[model samples]
Target: MNVLIITAHPEADSFNSYLAAKAARVFEKQGSVVNSVNLYSENFEPVEGKIFYPDRQDSVRFDALREQRHHWEKKILPDDVSRHIQLLINSDLLLLHFPFWWFGMPAILKGWMDRVFVYGGIYDSRQRHENGVMKGKRALLSVTAGAPENACGYNGRHGDMRLMLWSPIHALHYIGYSMLEPYLIHGVRGGLDGIAKKEQQKLLDEKVEDFENRLTNIHEWPIIPFNREDDFNEDKTLKPEAPEYSPFVRHDPDGWKKS
Candidate 1:
């Protein structure tokens, strides 16, 4: 099996980085070819520039701002986005590793998806009825969060961690990946100092082992079933839940008093 691991951590000594390295080792031991892309180390340009447009041939004449807008609209061509597409096409399993920042992925990782997982590679307007290019692939996410499991609940300070993963789950499912249950390490900041460091490492090692075992027995795991109905609930045409408000709320006492 060919596995591609994309790591989005800036610090070399970060726990996320350590987890990524351990996961890589396991894949190698399982006789799988592993290709790792360190986004920060490679200085991957997350912003889509004019270079991503087929129509904008001259780099000298390309407008960076215009290209940025075009990328947001998903209008770039396949050849322009070939490098990242080729990486996805060559791998059977794709593993994403990142630290949960403010209950979401780091900006760089989000940008990677914005640019690399483009229209032709991961989605296509023409193939609305059929699975896109990445169908039949497998994907797993490994994430580390500073908050404890209890805190990441509806009644707690931080909301459910699983809700933050909707983007990846829906995107991969739309493109036809057999999604594996995400392996999340909560309370990553819990054992940062003193004797807890050893315990933290041990716990991380165990999680890595589990990740490897799952990959080794990929075939045995039940594949994610494809159901168009599940994608969109019939009863609820619109998700009624209020849009998540950021924790950084601007207090306005006068406004509230008037109300």
Candidate 2:
């Protein structure tokens, strides 16, 4: 199996980076071909601009989608973008590692998605969701958060993690990846703050074990809930009768029925 690990932590010794390296080793031990992309080390350019697209269809007006498509069709995509795409194309499983910054991914990682997942090449109007080019590939998010586990839970101090991650999760699903249940290591900052240092270390160790287990048994991991093509109507709204895949689509206070 081919596994691509993309890490977006700025600090080399950060918990997320440690976990990413650990994941690589675990996957390698399982006899999988592991390839890692450290965004910080790469000094990846996160912004999409005209400078990256010299050969544009319309030089005056820069439409990112059109330019991306044009460059892809002309086989002149930026070297970095093209290389990232090639890695995704060749991987069976994609592991995304990053600390949850402001309840979302780091700018560099977000930029990776923006540039690497080309608008017309990997996905188009017709080639999204179930028909996405990456449909058969699997993606797993290994996230680190400063908040305590309870704080990120439903009705906890922090908002529900599921809801916070919905956009990115849906984006991954939209791009055709079968997403595995995210691996979350909570209370990360607590460790650094000297809050229950011994206990936090134990928890981190346990999380590492869990991550190793997940990697060793990657094929058996359950996919996260995502609305399928058939679940939506022609207008792209949920069918009134279809099961609600997420809380976002629900209207009633009772919310989504477990499917």
Candidate 3:
């Protein structure tokens, strides 16, 4: 299998970076072909701009979707975006490694999504959701958090971790990835200042071992039960009989039956 790991972390020594490297090694050991894209190291431009298009479809107003489609049809998409898109197209499994910042992904990672998941080329109005171009591919997220794991639980001050992940998870689903259960490593505080060095090392080792196990058994990973094509009605609302996949979509567990 072809595995692509995209890492978004500013510091090379950051925990997120370490997880990306470790995951690549694990995948390779399993006889999977691995390709890693380090956003920071590659100096990838996360922001979308008119400068990327030499021939503008709309010179005055910068419509991202319209331009994305236009450029793709014209075969004038930016070199970087085209290259990244090709990588995504070829990969069977995609691993996203990043730090959870302010309850979401870092800016660069968000930027990568904005620019790389291009419209027209990757998906169109009728080609998204369950029918997305990359429908058969799978994706997994590896996120590092500074807070303790309990803090992200249902009653924790940080709110439910699944709720925090809804947006990105849904976006990946829309783009046709079988979103795998995310791998999270919490309590990744900057350094071992407050705790003893030995304890810190022990904690790090435990997390690394967990990651190794997950990578070794990636094919057995459960994909998130996202809504499917049949789940929606003609108006785009949930079908009356469709099962609920997320709290964000079906506020009440039994709400789908009432639709």
Candidate 4:
């Protein structure tokens, strides 16, 4: 299995980076070829603008959709974006490592998706969801949060962590990945002084071992569920007979009205 591990963190020696590095080691132990992308270390750009497109279709106005398609067709994407896309095309599994920021992934990783998951090359109207060009691929997310595990759960202050992850869940699913249940570590506090530092280091070591175990049993990891093409109606609403995998995918046009 070819795996691509992408880590979005600024600190080179951070616990988040340690997790990412441990993940690579775990996969390597299983004889898998691993590729890693460090967003911060590599200085990956997350913004979209006309700067990347010098001779775009319209110089004045920048339409991401039109331009993405145009650039993809012309094979004129930016150097980094093109390289990233090439990596994605060659990999079978994507392992994302990041700390939960603002209830979601860091902006740098989000930018990686925006720039690398280009409209025309990565996805298009006809090449998305169950029929996405990236079908037959797998993706797993390992996230760390500041609150306790329960605090990020169903009735916690941070809300349902699964629901909170819908942003990336849907995004990856939409792009045709067999999403795995994310691995989350909570109660992650900063430690830079005295006994707190020692305790944090201990916790970090334990977490890395947990990640190793997760990777060791990776084949047994459950893939997150999603509806297939048949699960939706012609109007693109969930079929009444289909299972509602997501709370947001209910068969209720009026449910929004009630909310």
Candidate 5:
């Protein structure tokens, strides 16, 4: 198995970086090829400029932009988004490690997604049918947050972590990948004392083992909810093991629609 690890922490010494390294090592030890990409370290540009224009369907201009896009996607820059996409294409498992910034991923990681997951790559509504290009791949999120679990609940202070993490989860699902339950290390700033760090490392080690076990037995694990089963006409036949539904859905026969 090939695993891609995308690390979004700006600081080299951050706990998020540590977990990413640990994940890479564990995956390597398990005999999986590991590819590590650090967004901030690569100085990746997150903006999509005039490449997306309103009334410009000219082939010449389009081709020019496409060439530029190809360069950005293919050239190995310190932070090229294409390199990560290539890794994603070749890998079986994707691990995203980041320090939660304001209840979401860092801007650099978001930028990487914006530039890399382009129209013809991860998403293309016109060409995408039932199974997307990324079908059958798996993703795991390992986030370090400054808030406690109690602060990250629905009625609690921080709101639901799922709410904060829905974008990437939905993006991956839309492209036909399965998602593993995220492993979160909450209160990173508050929970990193001597003993706490040791406990956290132990817990992370156990979770790493669990991650490996689940990969080895992926068919036995529960299927990810809210995938594009409708395209396969399996909506009626399939039932979600988890009660969670997609927040992006606009309508539902039941009263579960998000208002």
Candidate 6:
């Protein structure tokens, strides 16, 4: 198995980094070829703009999609973007590690997605969703958050994690990856004072082992449910005949959508 592990954390000695390293060891032990990258360390640019396109369709007015497609067809995409896209194409599984900051991924990683998942190169209207180029590949997100697990649950103080993480899941799904159940480690920033020190250490060890064991049995894990292209109508609404999965896209026969 080929694995691509990406961690988006600024701190080199962060728990996310530790977990990423552990993930590498696990994959290596299982004889899987691993390609690891750190977004912050790479100095990855997060904003998408005209700089990527040296030769634009219309120099006066910039169109991101147009330039992306143009550069892609001309085979002049930025080296970093091309390389990352190639990694996605070559790998069978993707292991994403990051801290849940401001209720979503850090801007740097989000920018990485913006650049790497080029509009014209990675997905087009016909090639997206079920028909994406990465149709058979798998992706798993391991998120670490400072909030306690209880506070992050449905109707909790931190809001429902499921809803919060839906965007990333759908993004990967849109790109044709079969997403696995996310591995969420809550209370990552538990107090560092004396009384909590030993417990934190124990929890850290346990989580590392858990992450490894989960990957060891990765094949047995079920993929997250998503409606296929056929499941939607010409209007892009879910067909009544299809089984509804996400609240994001559901069949509302009465026209009054349920929240």
TM-score of each: 0.73, 0.94, 0.93, 0.93, 0.73, 0.95
- Candidate 1 structure, TM-score to reference: 0.73
C-alpha local distance difference test of each model: 0.70, 0.87, 0.86, 0.86, 0.69, 0.88
Cα deviation of 51, candidate 4, in Å: 0.8
Model 6, which residues run further than 4 Å from truth? 253-259
Give the least accurate 10-residue stretch of model 2, judged by summed lDDT.
250-259
Which pairs of residues have clashing backbones in candidate 5? Answer: 42-78, 42-79, 151-158
| Model number with the top lDDT | 6
Candidate with better TM-score, 3 vs 5: 3
- Model 2: per-residue Cα lDDT at residue 110: 84
Off by over 4 Å in 5: 51-79, 126-130, 190-222, 227-244, 250-259
List residue ranges in candidate 3 displaced over 4 A: 251-259
Off by over 4 Å in 4: 192-203, 252-259
State in Å the error of residue 239, model 1: 14
Count of clashes, each model:
0, 0, 0, 0, 3, 0
Q: What residue pairs are clashing in model 1?
A: none
Candidate 2, residue 45: lDDT: 95
lDDT of 2 at 74: 92
**Whole-model lDDT, model 4:** 0.86
Candidate 3 TM-score, true structure as reference: 0.93
Across residues 1-259, which tens digit of lDDT does each residue of candidate 3 receive? 9999999999999878988999999989889999999999999999998888878878999998899888998988988888999999999999999888899988998899899889988888888877898899999999988888899987799987767977777788788888999988888875566456576668878989988997898779888887777888888788878887776777466864564
Best by TM-score: 6
**C-alpha lDDT of residue 240 in model 4:** 81
